[model samples]
Target: MLPELKDISNEEVKLPESSKVRLFIKREDRIHPFVSGNKYRKLKYNLIEAASLGFDTVLTFGGAYSNHIAAIASAGKLHHFKTIGVIRGDELRSKKDYNPTLKFAQAQGMKLHFISREVYKNKTAQTFLEELKRTFGSFYTVPEGGTNALAVKGCEEILKPEDSMFDYICCSVGTGGTLSGIINASKPHQHIFGFPALKGDFLSDIISKFAMKRNWELQTAYHFGGYAKINNELIEFMNRFKAENDIPLDPVYTGKMMFGIIDLIKKGYFPPQSNILAVHTGGLQGIEGMNLKLKKKNLPLII
Candidate 1:
């Protein structure tokens, strides 16, 4: 059976009278302890497809600290499938030879394959994939972040009409699969907004091209310091949002996107009466090492 949908409620966040926006956050973060939010959607069908094809192992790619890797490790353990994580970049030479993500993934029985940056960049090439097929013996290879057609199909479920009254849907964009899926599944009348956590250079065009259907609107102004980077304001906002709404957001991902959504609404991005929905794409574990980096940088804590 497919995983059960856990929580269902509209937690309203009130804005200033001038803003005239009422935001309701869909807590997909609470979906699962490890396989949470968009990760769940991304992996759901891919896992089933792999099993049906009689594949006993799944291999995927990601950075040193990737939510995708964590999810795959957890899902593999739960479903009795072996997992291999092809991590980019070499192991650190300076500091202690340890990364929390890598450690946890190893603990979960996920074999790690570290590759040089240049080699990692060729991950999309058919030749490289063929090499992996030969190296890893037989396995279903899922692209980095599970950003593929099947993943987009799974995220389409996120746009289902809510039983409650709401008019808009918003969420952070990583590889754009989640947004693409939601946009694909959303009703024509409903407005969909995607807050890109990356620089706007060519991400919009890239996502737009992928989403050839041209059914949704995507914005890229709130990346803050770009992917995997965080700032004091973002950290403070994350802490405050959690304190007020009991919703935790990771600074490197959902927190930044969320801060942008609220800022845009407050700046007249949306009408006052409009009801907005924001998705919480889970990446809590990714924050572990980044948080330590922040603390070491002597950045002020938001506690």
Candidate 2:
């Protein structure tokens, strides 16, 4: 049986009075300890489908500090399925002890297969996937970032009926699955805003394949240089946000989205009295790993 999902709450964000916009965060992070936020949603139906198909093992792809990898490991352990992670960096194999995310995943019983960056680039190619199939035997593949159709189906349930009152629905985009699910389930009048963690126009095209509505726009200005790249300014913002709100945000995703939302509000991107709801797709498990990188670079760490 699947673990019970917790009742998620929308916490109102206290914004500056001059901004003239009201913001709230849907705390999807509170849903589960390990499989939180979009990870939980994305894995929900995929696990069900895997079991129904009689697959005893689940295989997926991720980087050294990927939340998807950690979540899948936890989910597989909880659901009685063997898990395999095709990790992007081959160098990470010897450094597993220093990487909190990978260490945690290993603790959860995931078999880690570290691959070269060049080979990892072809992860989605048919030939490379066939190679993985031959090596790992029969297993249910969850794709990189866990963004399959069944995953999107689970993500669509993130918003509730009361969420329609918000004028803007915002989220951080990775593989575009979570945002696409939100777009498909959103009310017509609500405009969806996506803050991509990666630098690309490619996400717009990718999301289009799964989204039924055209009521969404991608805000590409605040990726903090690219996926998993962080600066002192971002670290300061994350620390201050946690100090004030008591909510910890992961540097890779939620922190970047919140930063963009605040910047947009200050620039009058939203009309006066507009209500905005930002989806907190959790990655807090990655904070420890990110802090290690920050410390190594002599940068201010995310508290």
Candidate 3:
């Protein structure tokens, strides 16, 4: 059985004297060591529904260092369900031992199927799914980022009644599931700010599909290149933030979001005395793999 989730607490972020905004971070990372934050929420009902329908296996898609892939693999092992991970990049198939995320998933008994980038792009296509079913037999399928209706439902619980007091709710956007849930659950007066980990305005459209409210906006400038892409500045900011707050931020999501929030605050974006709560969606498990890439580039690693 999956471990019971604990009540996650929020950590206050001390701001500069020039900015009168009060910032706090909801530490969802503490939910579980492996399947934490949005990963835990997104998979909670998916796993339940999969079992209710008597599915013995769970199949999903992800890249080399996907938190969703790792979370599902861990969850499957704990719940006694077989797991299949259709990983992007065919070259990674032979180098599984080098990729920490894939290695851990495999060690947990998840069967890894590495496919080319082109084929991985069509993962949601009907033909692709049909082919997967023919190859692996029937199984419950979770999307690449684990964002679906059930996932959005699970994320809605991230905010509690006390959180309604905040004027702004901030979070990093991946597939937009977590933000959608937050938008649905947020009070009318609260404005939700989403920092996309990738470039482009397409995320706004994707988020609108699930979000029921119109009180949210996307801050697309802090992506720092694109998904899984990082720089020295971001690395420095992450390390400094951790050193000061004792809260580790993953480069893929939370780190970028927090960085953006601080920059915006410095620029006088928020009115004085505004209360902002940032959602710390956990992706810490992917840090080891990220550090490997940084080492290859001789760049500073996330602390």
Cα deviation of 16 in candidate 3 (Å)? 2.1
Per-model clash counts, in order, read: 1, 0, 0
lDDT of 3 by residue, 1-303 (tens): 456666789889977766788999999999888888999999998999999999999999999999999999999998999999999999998999999999999998999999999888999999999999999999999998999999999999999999988999999999999999999999989999999999999998899999999999999999999999999999999999999899999999999999999999999899998999999999999999999999999999888
Task: Output the number of the lDDT-best candidate.
Answer: 3
How many pairs in model 3 have backbone atoms within 3 A of each other, for residues 3 or more apart or on separate chains, i.e. clashes?
Answer: 0
Cα distance off (Å), candidate 1, residue 250:
1.1
Give me the displacement of residue 46 in model 1, in angstroms.
0.3
**TM-score of every model?**
0.93, 0.98, 0.98
Over 1-303, each residue of candidate 2 has an lDDT whose tens digit, in order, gives 357675689999878767798999999998888899999999999999999999999999999889999999999999899999999999989998888989999999999999999999999898988898899899999999999899899999999898989999999999999999999999989999999999979998999999999999999999989999989899999999999888889899999999999999989989999999999999899998888888888998888
Better by TM-score, candidate 3 or 1: 3
Error of 2 at 42 (Å): 0.4
Q: Residue 260 of model 3: what lDDT?
A: 99
- Candidate 1 is scored at a TM of 0.93
Order the candidates by TM-score, highest first: 3, 2, 1
